[model samples]
Target: MPVRGGDLHVGVWEPEGGGPAPPTVLAVHGITASHVGWAELARQLPGVRIVAPDLRGRGRSRDLPAPYGMPTHADDVAAVLDHLGAGPVVVVGHSMGGFVSLVLADRHPDTVSSLVLVDGGMPLLPPPGVAPDEMAGLVLGPAAERLQMTFPSRAAYRDFWREHPALGPGWTDLTTAYVDYDLVGAEPELRPATRVAALGEDIRELVDGDSVQHALDHLRRPATWLVAPRGLMDEVPPLYPDAARDLWTVRYPAVRMVPVEDVNHYTVIMLAEGAAQVRPHVVEALGEAR
Candidate 1:
């Protein structure tokens, strides 16, 4: 789909026997991720159309220019729906994609009927005085570091993720495909496709952007936030910790919070077990949209 800066790359999955016009869901992957992140979710929800896009500066859309912020990403999503001639579909967003979903719902109110936010969308304050530009590298840690890494070969990159504590234990063909798709550049010099500068701009907004805050304050759409118990590295202190969850719950009572057990930030949408848990909520949201 052609949007603002360039032709956006979108991945669509048609349900097993879903003829023309099956219920459609617009999915958005996390920061540093591409449309392939939704592979498992697409498989799990075989009756609905799963449409995911590689946000500008990520995946194949890596060349899409700057001004990479939530509003820009939201507009790109709106353009995708317009290009498809689709109206108000349920939107599911994971990680930074969740933040984009919030702004989309708020900015393009008619574009999203409801939302399923997986491990993102709520506010996450930065450590006091941390520079906005540094937040991505600071918070993301390894996920951020890998963007600058060079792989000797595809297998080397696969090996890196295969050793990941969270993804390795549950590794599947889907993971392999995702890892493969993420690599760009020639062999022996392949690097992940996400642009570091784009990530920094987006992360700055996620950490303390006014758009997210305003979106939450006036959020009227039905939304569900699913949280992972572990962090990106499968560590205990997940992105949205218990206290943060509790505070957000009190602050935005309208957005329901659900806890997904034994999954890290990545696995919550990247693996079968996590997708199984997320399936019902997505179904419910789609059902209610009708």
Candidate 2:
């Protein structure tokens, strides 16, 4: 693992018997998640070169100072890609990662040849208030605020996760490894590497405004929106009601939505279950564009 720009650390899982030019796939994790979030997808895509970098303030990467908003993150990814040799590769971003990918498209369109938004890419419903502070917690979710934690014992963390048996089916040790990757403070009392303020900025960028809400229908690129049927929702709206009109249906015609069955916000892209179906679609997108 090597650090670039003194901010991001690149950790790659090289595919066996595969050389460097295997249609590179850059895997950007969600809000709190690091590169490990895409372990399942990396494992499935055996031949391709999997480039997974720890986003700023998350895994192996050093956290930026407070007020680290979306632009900073998008620039960070662009730097990582440039470090990987100024690529025109596929960008697959999950959760908050998708937001960054969209920003990358808007900011550095040439670098990113195709976009694969895992469970997130478009602008989600904002918090009613006009203030970014109000939407910070709601947008980031539990992971953002307390993004990382190193437990005294992995078993202790495992036990903590056992409280919710529902996830046991799809998620395995990767989820556990992801939480423990961010080690901060003294050994016994480790904390998440990122600051809450920085996490807030990430959320703030997402709900900030019309910056991300481009006319998706005519964006003119091989971009796909792959979401779990019932992904993370900040607001309480009907499943298919009039108010939901502002969702995927009304806008983003070019955006292909794969309503993955038996998946939710966290597990859709983070967990292993969605990989079988999701990976092919994304790989296909990369192929279509490449």
**Which candidate has the top score in lDDT?**
1
Query: For every model shown, what is its TM-score relative to the native structure?
Result: 0.96, 0.83
Give the lDDT of residue 258 in candidate 2. 61
Worst 10 residues of 2 by lDDT: 234-243
Residue 147 error, candidate 1, Å: 0.7
Name the 10 consecutive residues with the lowest summed lDDT in model 1: 125-134
lDDT of 2 by residue, 1-290 (tens): 33334667776778779775667887777776677767778878887777877777666674554445566677778887777784787888887788778877777787778888876666666545646566655544555534455566545555655554334445477777765665566646666656556565567656544446652433645777775655344222312223333466556666666666666666766566777767887678677766
Task: Tell me the tens digit of each residue's lDDT in model 1 across 1-290.
Answer: 99887799999998888586789999999989999999999999989999999999999999999989999999998999999988799999999999999999999999899999999998775555877666676678788789999999999999999998878888999999999999999988999999999887888788778888888888979999999999888888788888889889998999999999888999999888899999999999999988
Q: Work out candidate 1's RMSD over C-alphas.
A: 1.4
Count of clashes in candidate 1: 0
Candidate 2 all-Cα RMSD:
3.6
List candidate 2 segments past 4 Å from native: 1-5, 127-133, 139-141, 144-151, 164-169, 214-220, 231-246
| Model 2 vs. true fold: TM | 0.83
**How many pairs of residues in model 2 come into backbone collision?**
1
Backbone clash pairs for candidate 1 read none
